[model samples]
Target: MQKFPAVLSVALLLAGCAMSSTQFDATREALRGSPPLRQQAIADCTANQARRSLQARQDAARVMNVSVRAMPRTICTRLVAGWSSGRLSYDDYRSAMVGSMTPNTVRIIQGR
Candidate 1:
């Protein structure tokens, strides 16, 4: 029983490490449809990701018996700014999303 719990915890932790390539491919396909649509899609995707992260934080806090607080509003601001300024390519944005969580966020999620 102890070994099972340890193994399961490791699996879950690794699962959150990064996004899969398939996810990036799908995003790329969606972005390729129309030149004008790219901006809207990117904005929407970023917003969705932020919202999901907030929700996940809340859920983790509850599971860990910790107090829930608002996440920083600027979490996705840098990403959007970089994208808007052409400082970030689609590949860079995708990789950023996959590795978006900060060390603090990871610590909270792991209940450390």
Candidate 2:
């Protein structure tokens, strides 16, 4: 009875070590098998999408008498988030900028 706790503790420690080693080997094999070219392609696609989103927001701001440089963080965040999610249409984007602007604000940027 006195040795039971010590035996159980040793068993548990060995099991934990074995599990960790299995996980490490699996991780190493997965990394070795993955194609780095595929990872680079995915990264490039993500960056291109981000650039398109930013351009859309700037275009919207120009049409609405809104200053793109002076835009609130919330507006930019919403633009990117909504655009990426497809929650906001091109028309919706145009409407939001126009709707949010003050009536007296003259549109400095032409061609809405």
Candidate 3:
């Protein structure tokens, strides 16, 4: 029974790590063609950032056992705009979106 729990934990962790790149690839594939479609996706994604931010905050709060403040409106706007204007690839845009929601991820990306 004890070994089973340890095995399950390791399996779950590895599963999560494996899915990370897969999710990114899937997003990129979905946005592969059609600049107009990509633009529309960026527009829609930008509009939804606020909600995503709020959800991220709530999730973090739950995990850290602390109260979380409301997410600000300006999160990820520049990156989304870059994607909207064709200045960023889909992968970069998706990374920015993820960074906007996760402070740790942003910090890591910023090398801070």
Candidate 4:
């Protein structure tokens, strides 16, 4: 029916107008397509969220060239715990930290 086509277009329009969570997350401003780091989960990574409340309590300090306080709470805690436990390698922590802090730009996704 003619009404069905109109209804379909309305549905598509509504869906298109919807904004993704990244549009509003402050931490994710640096990351494109990547939601806030708070949304980035480390699979199989285990840390007591408060367990690393769990603090060296140092700010502006660098370990593995990563800012101690710069990362999201869950990520920072896991990184610290994993590092201290000797389970996470220096390279691992460094890569994860730097990657998290790096601003994500559209250029990163351009096809060569």
Best candidate, TM-score:
3
lDDT by residue (10-36, candidate 3, tens digit) is: 211212342455654454455455566
> Ten residues in a row with the worst lDDT in model 4?
103-112
CA lDDT of every candidate: 0.38, 0.34, 0.36, 0.27
Candidate 1 residue lDDT tens string, 1-112: 0111221122122123444556544444554555455555445434443445455545544543544442222222333333334443444434334434334333333334
- How far residue 93's Cα lies from its native spot in candidate 4, in Å, is 3.2
How close is every model to the real structure, measured as TM-score? 0.28, 0.23, 0.29, 0.22
Full ranking by TM-score: 3, 1, 2, 4
For all candidates, the clash counts are: 0, 0, 0, 1
Q: Which pairs of residues collide in candidate 2?
A: none
- Candidate 1 segments exceeding 4 Å error: 1-50, 53-55, 58-72, 96-112
Cα lDDT tens digits for candidate 4, 31-110: 22343432332222222222233233122122223344432243433432332334433333223223322111111111
Which candidate should be chosen as best, given lDDT against the real structure?
A: 1
Candidate 3's clash total is: 0
Writing each residue's lDDT as its tens digit, candidate 2 over 24-83 gives 344334433555632433344334323444555465444444565433332333333333
Q: Which residue ranges in model 4 land beyond 4 Å of their true spot?
A: 1-71, 97-112
List where candidate 2 sits over 4 angstroms from the true fold.
1-71, 97-112
- Candidate 3 error regions (>4 Å): 1-20, 50-112
